[model samples]
Target: MFSTVYDVIVVGGGHAGAEAAAASANLGAKTLLITMNLQNIAQMSCNPAMGGIAKGQIVREIDALGGYSAIVTDKTAIQFKMLNKSKGPAMWSPRAQSDRMRFSETWRNMLEQTDNLDFYQEMVTGLLFEDDIIIGVKTALGIEIKSKTVIITAGTFLNGLIHIGNKTFGGGRAGESAATGITEDLVKKGFESGRMKTGTPPRVDSRSLDFSKMIEQPGDVNPEKFSYLKTTTALKEQRSCYMSYTSLDVHNLLREGFDRSPMFNGRIKSVGPRYCPSIEDKIDRFASKERHQIFVEPEGWNTIEIYVNGFSTSLPEDVQDKALRKVAGFENVKFLRYGYAIEYDYFPPTQLTKTLETKLITNLYFAGQINGTTGYEEAAAQGLIAGINAALKVQNKAPFVLKRNEAYIGVLIDDLIIKGTEEPYRMFTSRAEYRTLLRQDNADLRLTPMAYKLGLASKERMDRVVEKQEKTDLFVKFLKETSVKPEEINPILEANNSARISQSMKLFKIAARPQLNFNDIQKINSVASFITENNLDNEVIEQTEIHVKYAGYIEKEKNQADKLNRLENVPIPANFNYEKVKSLSIEARQKLTKIQPETISQASRISGVSPSDVSVLLVYMGR
Candidate 1:
């Protein structure tokens, strides 16, 4: 019954798929989102939270690029936090605890309202291909849907197998059935694939827990939102999360199910996420630790269902209950559902190009768990990039690819294509070397302009970025040009434990002091009046302050990035013959041939390719 040739068809409706559909359609393409169940769109499969550490920066970047993630998060947030407030602005990250039901509902509502987008409920069984290029998808019911481009964001659903102790079932999620045919079809088409495992924590009944015994973790007194746009407001009457610990007794009780544990007993062969290991994995890895922390978080504004964070396990239900009961605040906890681990097929990301399009198939792209990444933020970022690039390819335009120095999304895609993660990949601040320039506060300044040049970001979003840039620039200039008299600044400096200046100094210079801040400096009459007259908000003032404070460091990073980008400009032909470069090591040759890096900078980043190999390639290219 599907006769129309859609511009783009996105398979799976998780965070990644949703963004892909929204992005492609927002770019004026006729797009269709096919999910196994429309009700579960944008489901929070693990935690009921968004944006933490590096992931938060990614959400902001997505929003700056006109993606809907940050807006949806802000609309549904029940609690808000700016994590790592004590650290530098580069470390600062915005996080939100979302109402799970509302998060899903918001996504569906936005998608329905979005123009040029359509929705369907169907399991994509196989891809329709002509030669090596993808043409469309075939559903389980044998309905063939035609599309010019396809983005597969099938998160943990390809031949997925769930395990809880000895019980095993074929399911994508806890209750959803596993998707078939696609993985086998792809493998037969000469694509390499492997297995990965990820687990979730049990959902406990909030009424059953004893919160009085646990420490309450409250949200920010003055909460902030994820969106740069004013679509969402700050949360009021936030719900507090509780922190509890798992004692030695709880560990010993959990260990009782070691013999039945699928992870330990070899039932699960794939590696799980190293950063977010399960409770049993933690106990096994960190035996010296007497207790592990557990966070008890509320599921939503209305529900009594609580998420037992930091207690993810795939142990038997009896053992899970027994161990959980021993925790200080969960003495009589009742499980809404037992946690389980699921193993699913994933293609090694090295097979994909920097634009996230498959080298083997034209107009076909992969994002999210299908590319072996974990976390909703990571998936969503990938989806946005993939969606943008896919639409660009369809329209016969230049492919959009972020660089390592520009954004975290850039580092993520570069890392995946170059390093090719052995286990499930998750974003960390350490992963981006130029993180100082990639702060959450300046995501719009970095990406929105680029996105505007493309058709993806709206004129309103572009105008906001322009205004913010103009305001920040003016504020910085004011700080640099305005001088503070010793009498105007000495009292503030003395209060902050800084030496009082004997003479007048520029406000920018005073702000550069380690102990001083913009808030204290703003108390000066001239500075305060200047801010008021310019209509500068906290965001603009903060941006100006950070720029003045970290100008030297930011310049140094930019210089380094520019130096490396010179190497990046040295293009390598797609069909370059690495075999002819006999001076290269055998391992380097094989890796270079397999990865087929687009630039010399990318070649240098590959694991086996050494500096000597790069030198040889440089010489060869020069010749």
Candidate 2:
């Protein structure tokens, strides 16, 4: 192990690192996964949940690409809910609250079972470089191992500084030690470094709190799984999460600790997630709001630990306790762990290419928090792409990059590399311009073929994709061709409060009505007969409905995406000189020069670049 060279060495065993190792190894690369503590592999460092809103789509996409996040989540999920179900299919996202310990254990078992992969327990101290390219990694014990590529998914470990009240300590997580040497080494090597902070809420003893005082939020009546694979099944039994609210009194109790709060007292300067603000931040930002809802979530199926969601704080321990006592259902709460904030070092993702390989260092990559992204889904997506690209580079194959229209993964990376987040970047459905075309339900149909071609997805997965596509198309055809009598369809239309049909109509037309959903229209005798005769599954039915109901919107989005794709597909020469474009704006030239965008479309997305700059580039390219 000491003398042999590996194809890819993945540092950090968080979501990103684990996925990177798995993807690299599964692609036939001799991969090695190194972590400070092997037992904590793929730990749910923050919330004990996977997939929410756009995040759920990301997990499904990972599974479609033959990664393991969805499978693990589904297997260990205690609670499952499809978020935004009231909205369109594009907004419907599947989420799962997992058994925290079992989630990590499941990930470890999966990694252990992956062939061509090795595990090592050590803290990486620095990189072994061949000039500008990283050749391997150096461990804390001074042992060096050679590798063709190194992916650092260090997460919140690099120079981690935790805060509680005015007191700060060196810890990546609550108890784990902060990593050293690597951040300093990279800075010395001329990488631009920045700081970002993220925090977790206190985990209290569930038995100590009165759930009757809070609202019971149960899982969906018919809970769904995240993975497209049939191997993982839906939850047969479920767990319920309780909801409580923080009042003006709770806010007043919290404000008393403001003097000691690291966030408010200027003890912590780095930015946290804008979308997921802490309790203090929320209170301070929205002073007039009477209350903020708090969700009390169980940590596992058999545990007293309860995560106090929506109450993330870095105030004194007593302050956290005092504030929670003021809340309705927590008059006598016992904390298992106090809430605290941690600041860590991150490299601006603009330093990375579309494939996540560093522009300055060949074969070297960064994923997860190191790339300034928050959430397990974002990190795992980056890791999966980095791992795949690293392995492809080693195997002398073309790098795989997803377009923004193709997947949410594409929107994330494109945003990171182009916009370059100063704060922690998170994914949202609104971030995707073509979200309707990138719905969570159709990820397999969009991505499995590509993954299969890359040798990442299995033949079974490909077969599933083909069957889904063929059946969905056939069902849609049947709906369009078959006609239903007015008497048969009128009752169903009346049930939905829609005007009765005067005569016979095609089932497709009836299904497309704004008021009539799949459930409403499926009651028709002909539709039910067709479903029973074809033996179509729920997935095929859902796909066919989405295709039929949102056909115009979907087609509109596709046309828009195809139009923009022309500019996206325009290639910029690798050695293209921005210095020659003197007619471009000063800020545009400077940003373009530094970013070195690969296409005219990418150039337009840069902050300083305007339409005029893009026009100049288009003119120069003789388009």
Candidate 3:
């Protein structure tokens, strides 16, 4: 029997639940985090790494919004690499290969150290609801703890069914038991749910692979970190990942098991991530290709366990071993664990508000795979938002929602609530219309202020953001004012085969040229002295160069975002009858009524609501 009523109760201690608890407790909420297995807190159940492509941006945004993901990742990272560095700053993303056990331990330590947070290990069997609102949760042991709000980050545990080859069993993961009752309870309480599938590649012993047969993929020479806080430092020592290719012979060997593959044998009824397909799916889909790449990634500095990236399969164990050994470097590959595909329950995210609170169940929120998202960063982002809003609700404060132009988190939640994914939702840079504005380098500049106001981000974070902004502004001003004479810049320009300027050019203009980057610009005496005089770090210089180079694109994207935001400002009445809008398409009306969008902008983004439909909604809003 609990003596105190918690302000927030988080179910399942994965990335999402962990973040939700931290955010709520940090915002002054009396929070309790309950998990079936405390030992698996923030488990990297899939890959032993964090941050990739747009997921990296989400991790940085989570850090800016006062979440523990990036901090923990930095502390446990064995290797660091900034992906897409050859591209523009907008494309640059930070990725780290973490020591698996260390990452989980770091997360647990961070949670335990957080004030106002308590931990409980129990399977939350069902939610305790009063009428249509959440009040608490019931454990499998029949303990009912009271809470003002509940966030379900159950991950892939609800009625989970795992498939390996022709074999199927009830399980959330390899050895983890499936969580029952909660999904059924939710459905009975008027929540709709669906199923989705995701899988992890086999883990092999590193000693079994031949490194000479694969290409070495080393970490970046100048590795960048995920967290914006100065407390975490970059990795000095790094581990190398090896890239090996699977030949046609390997594909043929895998093809021999297509008859037994759960994915191909019609055993998996749900959809999996289209981009991250299993090896069997890949071979079948791209039959013309002779080979596919597989990454041999080290799980930790001390462990010999290797993650076999891009070889996810639900084929027979014998077939998996046979196909794996055919790969260039995996000739003597020994499996630590065979790959598996799991089918789990997920609620249609469209049933939730932008705050991640279910529209049908007051104070009952959803995050992680329960909301149909598939990455740790995505789950953590949703958890941060849900936790902040849940705590703010208890405090009688207005809800916090980020605009799409501000962060990828915003785009992700917006996409889910409006469009609703039929398959597992994964983040990509292309998904963000204003990716240039939402660059990884500017996550703190975009989100830390709002987080600080909510008391989630610390004052130290706020101070750092302020300092970075001030210095970046001053540096940009200096670049604009200082002119580079032909004698001072032409030689450098000529060496790079760029058009030589006859007249004096502003330092900003010279820096903006396509062929010139910060490295190239640093060659100028004035630029070098200005950087040295200001004692500017690489971060500040990086920010300055991006601003100078992408000024036009950034401005254009901002203008477009502004246009959409205007529609966002147009409010729709909560009880507005869509049936009365005769001019609206039947599909639009149905979507509007079902989703009950709060803003014309949100309605515009709905799948069935078109430009014409948005026009009608705007007219109804007196726009």
* lDDT for each residue of candidate 2 in 1-623, tens digit (9 for 90 to 100): 48889999999999999999999999999999999999999999889999998999999999999999999999899999999989999999989999999999999999999999999999999899989989999999999999999999999999999999989999999899999999998988899999999999999999899999999999999998999998999999999999999999899989999999999878899999998888999999999999999999898999899988899989899989999998988998999999999999999999999999999889999999999999999999999999999999999999999999999999999999999999999999999999999999999999999999999999999999999999999999999999989988888788779989898888888888889888877787778888899889999999998999899999999999888899998888985888888999999988988888999889889998999989999999989
- CA lDDT of every candidate: 0.94, 0.94, 0.92
Clashes of each: 0, 0, 0
Per-candidate TM equals 0.99, 0.99, 0.99
Residue 92's C-alpha lDDT in candidate 3? 88
Error of 3 at 311 (Å): 0.6
lDDT tens readout by residue for model 1, 252-328 = 99999999999999999999999999999999999999999999999999999999999999999999999999999
Model 2 misplacement above 4 A: none
For model 3, the local distance difference test gives 0.92
What does candidate 3's lDDT look like per residue over 186-276, in tens digits?
A: 9998888999999989999998889999999999998888999989999999999999999999999998999898888788989999989
Q: Candidate 3 — number of clashing residue pairs?
A: 0
Task: Score residue 619 of candidate 1 by CA lDDT.
Answer: 95
Location of the lowest summed lDDT over 10 successive residues in candidate 1: 228-237
